[model samples]
Target: MKLTPLEIKQQTFEKGLRGYDVADVQAFLTLVSNEFEHLLNKNKELEHEIEKLTDRVKHYERVEEALHETLQTAKESVEQKMDGAKQEAKSTLQKAEMEADAIIKEANHQRQQIRQSILRLLDRREEIINGISSYLDNAKKSVNQFSKDDMGTFKLPKEEDLEESIDKVTSKSSYSRFELDEEDLEISSYEEEDSAFAPGSDRLDDILDEID
Candidate 1:
């Protein structure tokens, strides 16, 4: 059977007439018991150390798993943010294009307004020139009626006032210098007042209404 330390100590051998020395047998047993006790203590210390190392390994594995999960989550979050940023960029670009188109359309409308104003100025200038021509023709036919004093009293017209007044002339149909029949170049001048003026006075209010 197996011998423990206490059982080894209790073991006794029957003495033979000269088989073994008494002191030698007892000394050998004592040595064996001491060695066994030392080995048992050493084995227990080694087992405890191994368990501590195994626990440390398990703890490290848990920490590594947590860190990996965190890294994966961070990567996913970054990807989502990038996706949102891309969509926002696209939306911003679309808004910018729409704004640019709106600005261009408004500018085109303003340009058309300017072109119409220029055309009106040209038509008014033509009418004023035609009226002046008719006046000159009438004056030539009634040259006897005009005295030298009357001629001297006639003022040299102010350039700014004459151009501005021509732009306001309402009788453009009655006094058009433009010839649809045959285009030609000619300059003319006219008196500000005449008897052939039809209805009431050509008031400033009427001119303002035509501009509107």
Candidate 2:
């Protein structure tokens, strides 16, 4: 039968002619019962302490697991962000390089156009200078030739006489812008064919060819 501390303390023994000593047995039983009760109480306290310690250990384990998961998630997020930043930097660099190249190309094209315009302006300036030089040379020749020709008296010639002289000289290759009307042709000259067909006439032809 199961025996509790109280049951052991209250147990009784049958009387006998040669049984163990009653006082000694009863005293020993009482002592054993008190010691058993103390041991049971101590065991119960130890069990409760073990249960509390186990709960504490389980809680710490859960915290450690959560911390590990959080650390891993943070690591992944940082890596992803780093990758995105690198890609963005690369794209931005490429765009900047393309823009710089385009600007350089445009600048080069503008420089080429400016250079061409300068060259064309220089050619036109040279052409104008040559034309002016030729005109001056022809004017010098015509003046020298007219000085050699025999001029009449210091008086001006009549309009009809001037017209007749101009008609005889202008029978060859013609010129523009030098068309002398009645008033403009009132210059005195010798009435001879050789005087009319002198260096002045040839110089005039040269001037007209240059103009043409």
Candidate 3:
């Protein structure tokens, strides 16, 4: 049984012949009971302080875990955004390369067309030159065929036959340089005629016979 300080002070033993001193024991017990109550109250206060410190420690641990989780989430978001930027840059580079290649191909095609046109122009110029050369040759042959005899020698005009005829024709108007040279050659050949007609009037008549 627990003893109160008041109960310990109240209890006293009577001392008769040869009995121990009971009053002194009761007073000492009262003092010891009061000291024990004081010690128990102080121990209870220390236990409450320890419990509160433990709760604070638990709260701090949970906060540290939440901070770590938030840091990891932020790092993951940054990495994902960087990867998307790299992909977009790669696609843009590829598109630029394609555009450059298309431009080169178009330039090559235009160069080929220009080369073909130049070749065609050269070929057409050659054809025109050949046609003009043929026409000049034919015109030279026609000039060789002109004859004083085909026009017929003048009948009974004078002794100097071809010169007199050319003079009469030119008196109307002047003839070209070719006709003037022909008349000069015929006037030089007046001695070649014996009967009434000459065998060869001049080299002009000879040239006319060769042409016919």
Candidate 4:
């Protein structure tokens, strides 16, 4: 049913009255077959080239898809790493803040303790100073009373009597200028020998020694 180039070249026409010239018709048929065969070969070449181009396009599409997937995976991995780093940093920061707060609290507590100790020391010093001041005031009052009593009751002997009394008692015994009451006279005479005792000098010394 289909006519190839070879079939067209080999075709023949039946002889009849007023029929075309056989040689001319055969020559034309040969020329048409050759031209058609050339056209067919060119179409086949074009089809082969189109098939090669199509295969290349499919390969390029596969490569592009693979690149897209790789990029997406890389982006996700980067985001995950960044999030992890952020969380670690936040945790570290919180820990540092807590530690700092604890240190500050401890320091404040120590400072309060030190302050309390200083206040207690100051109070104790004040108490000691007050006790000493009260003792000294009482001692001063006792010394003043003793001086007034001595001035009122005691008298100095004459220079001639004093020299004679000193010579008389030099080898026998010592004497006190003070005349004590009957209850204290014996003890005072035995304990005290200095007739030149000043008003508050020896008495003040005794009181200070007692205090000590």
* lDDT string, candidate 1, 7-76, tens digits: 6666689998878887888888888887877777788899999899999999999999999999999999
Q: How many backbone clashes does candidate 1 have?
A: 1
TM-scores vs. true structure, each candidate: 0.53, 0.54, 0.37, 0.51
The order of the candidates by TM-score, greatest first, is 2, 1, 4, 3
Residue pairs with clashing backbones, model 3: none
What lDDT does each candidate get? 0.72, 0.79, 0.68, 0.79
**What's the C-alpha lDDT at position 133 in model 4?**
67
Candidate 4 residue runs with Cα over 4 Å from true position: 1-3, 117-212
Model 1 gets an lDDT of: 0.72
Candidate 2 per-residue C-alpha lDDT over 1-212 given as tens digits, one digit per residue, 9 for 90 to 100: 65678988888899899998989989999998999899989989999999999999999999999999999999999999999999999999999999999999999999999999999978876875676666567666756765663666556889999999788778756555567776545442233444434333445555455446
- Candidate 3 lDDT for residue 179: 57
State how far residue 95 of model 4 sits from its true place (Å).
Answer: 2.5
Write one digit per residue (lDDT tens) for candidate 4, span 167-191: 8876564455444688687767755
lDDT of 4: 0.79
Off by over 4 Å in 3: 1-35, 103-212
Candidate 1, poorest ten consecutive residues by summed lDDT: 183-192
Error of 2 at 154 (Å): 14
> What are the per-model numbers of colliding residue pairs?
1, 0, 0, 0
- What is the TM-score (0 to 1) of candidate 3? 0.37
